[model samples]
Target: MPLYVWLACGLYWMNGMATVVLGSVLPLAVQHLHTTYVFGSDLVFLQFVGYWIGVPLSSMAVRRTGYRGAIVASSAITALASAGFTAWPKPLPYLVCSLANGIGMALMQATVSTSLIEWFPARRAVIMSRTEAAFGLGCVLGPLFASACIAAGRWQVAFALVAAAAAALAVVGAFTPMAARDSREGPRDAHTDAIHLANRRDRALVLALFMLCVLIYVGLESCVNNFLPAVFVEHFGLPATTASVAVSAFWAAMVAGRMATGWIARKLPYRPYLILAALGTLCTTVVLAATRSVVLGYVECVWLGLFMSGIYVVTLVFANHAFPDLTGLVTRLVTFFAGLGGATLPYAFGWTLAKTGSQWADVALALFAAVLFGVVGWTGWVTKRKSRSPSERVHAAG
Candidate 1:
């Protein structure tokens, strides 16, 4: 692995920690702010709004300053905003910080994903899964880190720690030697380009499906990470400190799952992998909805994480494989929907939980999982159907 890859992985690791930091501290933060869960959900919504805005801006930033400059800028913004958490300690200020954090995280995410896909076109699935696994590793540790801070009765320190890490990453980005644009760009295969261009409608349809999948998938993931701790506390009667452990268990399972996926995905066809993942997620959600045992809830979280781990990366690689020449655009569009889903779904979950209770919230998640399963199935059918066309057959032979 190159130095750049290591740097990218480190950045993603920080991103994972930053992404979960709010969720980890949310229950405590709500109490600290003297606010309700609805406000916290709004914070989550605003943060993802920043993400929604940041995805396109990330492309512009990359165009203007290249990968290193964009990354450094993002890191600086994240660090500054995160530091505000300790300074203000008010509802409005915290919302502003969360929004800024989302933008910074989104920028870094788009930059890293595009850079890696360009740099290693042949091994996209393997590399993406591994980097995503690095992300999962950060998620695993983030809750534990926050749990420690909460245990010490200094929950604000979690954001402070995140700020320090972001600052250090900015310094790292400033010093690192990133590949030049021309060198990093992958070659465009003429045959593949022609096949896609000739079937413009099919290509559009597939891209739309892919985007929809990303939207729902990301929303589902955000809901789980952000609300699972809350569920543990309110429904399972677990303490805040103990509830955070469920998040750790969930992400720990994701890390293991993604590591295995990086290898297994190379052999497994995209269609089956996606279908099975969705099916597994649906089953886990059902089990989670029905189970009342605290131990079973924790175990179900791990199972759910394992099932959901590879969907994003695998879908990303699958999309790029279908449209090789538009890696940057495809990445941006996918992540844009990702931000959209993350913003909307979790807010809805929070609202639902605030009003109806955890049982209904669990039903909502299971329903979403079922929809995701259906979407994945539809996407697979479309892709397979397109492949069987005469033009595709000729391209495959040639």
Candidate 2:
């Protein structure tokens, strides 16, 4: 791996850490802010608002500042916003901070995903899977740290810690060697250029499929991560500490799964691997929804994480490969939808929990998984149908 890859992974780790820690501390945040649980989850919503706002600006930021500079700037923003968490019991200030954090996340995400192509052209799938594993590792660790902070009655310190870490990452990112153009502006592949020009409709269909897949998956995953701890506490009557541990286990499985996926992607066909992952997600979510025992629920959560690990990265990588010329555009579009998902779904999850019941939360997640399975399966059908057209032409000639 290059220095840029390490820097990118570091940013992703911090991104994951901050997002998960916010979820883990939701109970405290709600109480401190004097809000309901549904409203407390708005912290996740606001951050993604900043993310959506930053997506369009990220392209210009990267162009002007260079990838390294953009990363440094975004990291600084993350640090500043995280420090704002110290203004606890004040909803307005905290919401403002969350919005800032989302913008930072958006800028960094766009730059890192785009830069990795230049960093490793041949091993894109493997690198992306591994980089997401770094994110999973952060998720695994961040909640435990947050739990400890909560236990010590200094939950705000977790935000301070995130700020300090981001500051350090910004410093490291400043020294990394990444070009302003990221090698995308160099030469064009005539074959790819021709393909993009000729197959406009196919390209549109593929892009649409990927964007929708990313949105639904991100929404489902965010809802689970943001609200799962609350479900455990409110429904199962578990302590916050125990709930945090459960979240940790879920993310630990995600780390392990992504590592495994990086290896498997080398051996398996892309479509089949995706089908298997979707199937696992669907099954695990069902079991999670049905199980009543807390121990069984924890085990199911681990499976859900493992199954859900690489879908977003794979989707991003696939879109990049499909349309190399539009790397930045595709990155922004997919990421924008993803941020939109993160912004919307957690609130919906909270709303469902508030309106219907906790049991319905799992049902909602399962439905999302089912939709993912259908969409992936539909892509394969489209490919098969398209493949048959050539044979049909031959038969007509015969």
Say which candidate scores most in TM-score: 1
Model 1 over residues 282-324: C-alpha lDDT tens digits? 9999999999999999999999999999999988988888888
Residue 288 error for model 1, in Å?
0.5
Worst 10 residues of 1 by lDDT: 186-195
Candidate 1 residue-pair clash tally: 0
**Residue 129, candidate 2: alpha-carbon lDDT:** 79
lDDT of each: 0.86, 0.79
Runs in model 2 lying further than 4 Å from the true structure? 179-198, 384-398
Query: Looking at candidate 2, what is the lDDT of residue 304?
Result: 90
For model 1, what is the alpha-carbon lDDT of residue 340? 93
Give the top-scoring candidate (lDDT): 1
